[model samples]
Target: MSAEPLVADHAHEVSDHGHDPHATTTGLSHIKLAMWVFLGSECLLFGGLISTYLLYKTRGNGRTLPTDVFDIPFTSVSSFVLLMSSLTMVLALSAVSRGEAEAGRTWLLATALLGGVFVGGQVYEFTAFVREGVAFTTNPASSAFFTLTGFHGVHVSLGIVMLMSLFVASVKGKLTQRNAETVEIVGLYWHFVDIVWIFIFTVIYLIPAD
Candidate 1:
């Protein structure tokens, strides 16, 4: 019967519909769309690399062919490490969703460290290959192999940088529960890159050449 109570009840009803004037846009949707666009472009870039690899798979000289030089066990372990990083990435997103900022930051840092390990493995592998007479200019196979894997390594390094920045921002209170959606979007991109490696590893290391 009171005017003030009537207005308060109407205000509560509107708030339930999420019709607040101060409502912030959930940026996850835009971030996801941007990521998709980026990945689409990356597909073309990687498609070129893969085509080159196939074109050169059988053209190497007396140097180590893929089957000859691929250390399957070592690469398999590295592949698993990269895959586990994806799991850590998802855990980071989950932590942010649960408003556990510390846990989220921890997982993000773990993911970056794992990524660094993967990159280090790649560097060692490439160095060993070079020492074994697989110079980039020695043959098409060497060139293609180095080019494809090197490109992927660069991407992984960039991802690690982003993850570190995210973790630091979280530490400084720049990234907060309110930005959980942003964290989820970054995790989505990181996971996509990891999955792409599955196909890359299969083609580059597992499949037999004709």
Candidate 2:
């Protein structure tokens, strides 16, 4: 028996209850599907970066590797903060799903704050690296290192912007249980960025540079 009618009935009921429904005949919503595709492409992009970094990190060609000046303890704390933001994102989605707009906004803001802290840490680390003479043009290793980590910092910064947007929407009374899917989509992106950082922190920071 086709379950299309059942899903259609459920969607109708949700709509009548003042929820968005965000219904589609297709199993997956178009936006969500597109996000998955974008993330897939992103994986390939990061893969190339990591491979390039690994290739050149061991071949500094007389220039000091950026990894040589890494502050592992500081970055470990930053990584922890970013990972915690993913948890806050989940809480935000859960709150929105349950129609707790105030709680949702609180978690959303918290997540954004965590992300901001991580980015701030990255900026400080980059400054310290430059002070230690690890300029991007100093060597191939430094170029690859900056390129990979800089791209990740950009992604995290964008995720913070998205979370702030959701928080603003809640404050403006435009976000409710009906908009849960929106929070979920943002959460998906935020979690992906955090997960990517785990791989980055492991390979770029934890691995021995020598």
Candidate 3:
């Protein structure tokens, strides 16, 4: 019944929980948890935008129906590029996790390049749409369409900026495994953007306009 024996038993009990003494008590990294919360809020935001678009979609004047202006083939190619960027992002994360800094940076650059291509395609599409009388002020349908898709384009652009920043950090030796969690967090955002695009593409472009 010595106090020393009681203290030893308490220490053993604490260690039995398999908790890392140096890790956060919540068992998840704080940054990742924050990212999840941010993404969740984004889901609500995007959901509202999509609902608005769907509601106004059928309100377009005959001159600006989606079918008349949407370039499916061009969008298909852009979608493919964005989807492949997700793959490259995974590769980049894998490389970083494995401590292959050069390969990780290379893959990151590739991901960013592909994202750029997708954004460029979107810009071209938007310009073409404007030239064909699909301005944001043209009608309710056009406004909703521009708002929803423009928001997505801005997200992609921001993701590209993040990727480029990560690449620069990697080159500066600031992206070691000790802080590789940063890259993983950014990757999560990138993947989320790509997934959102999949939904948008299917809903806005692939389905036949009514």
Model 1 global lDDT (CA atoms, 0 to 1): 0.82
Per residue, candidate 1 scores C-alpha lDDT tens digits across 1-210 of: 213312232233334445454332442244456678888888889889989998988887876765567778889999999999999999999998898999999999999999999999999898888887777787888898899999999989989999999999999987877788778767877887797799898988888776
What's the CA error at residue 104 for candidate 3, in Å? 0.4
lDDT of each: 0.82, 0.87, 0.86
TM-score of each: 0.84, 0.88, 0.88
Off by more than 4 A, model 3: 1-22
- The per-residue C-alpha lDDT of model 3 at residue 163 equals 95
Top lDDT model: 2
Query: Cα-based RMSD of the predictions, in order?
Result: 7.2, 4.4, 6.4
Clashes of each: 0, 0, 0
lDDT of 3 at 151: 96
Poorest stretch of ten by lDDT in candidate 3: 1-10
For model 2 the TM-score comes to 0.88
Query: How big is the RMSD of model 1?
Result: 7.2
Judged by TM-score relative to the true structure, which candidate is superior, 1 or 3?
Answer: 3
For 1-112, candidate 2 gives per-residue lDDT tens digits of 3243234423444344344444565646666777788999989988999999999887678978887899999999999999899999999999999999999999999999
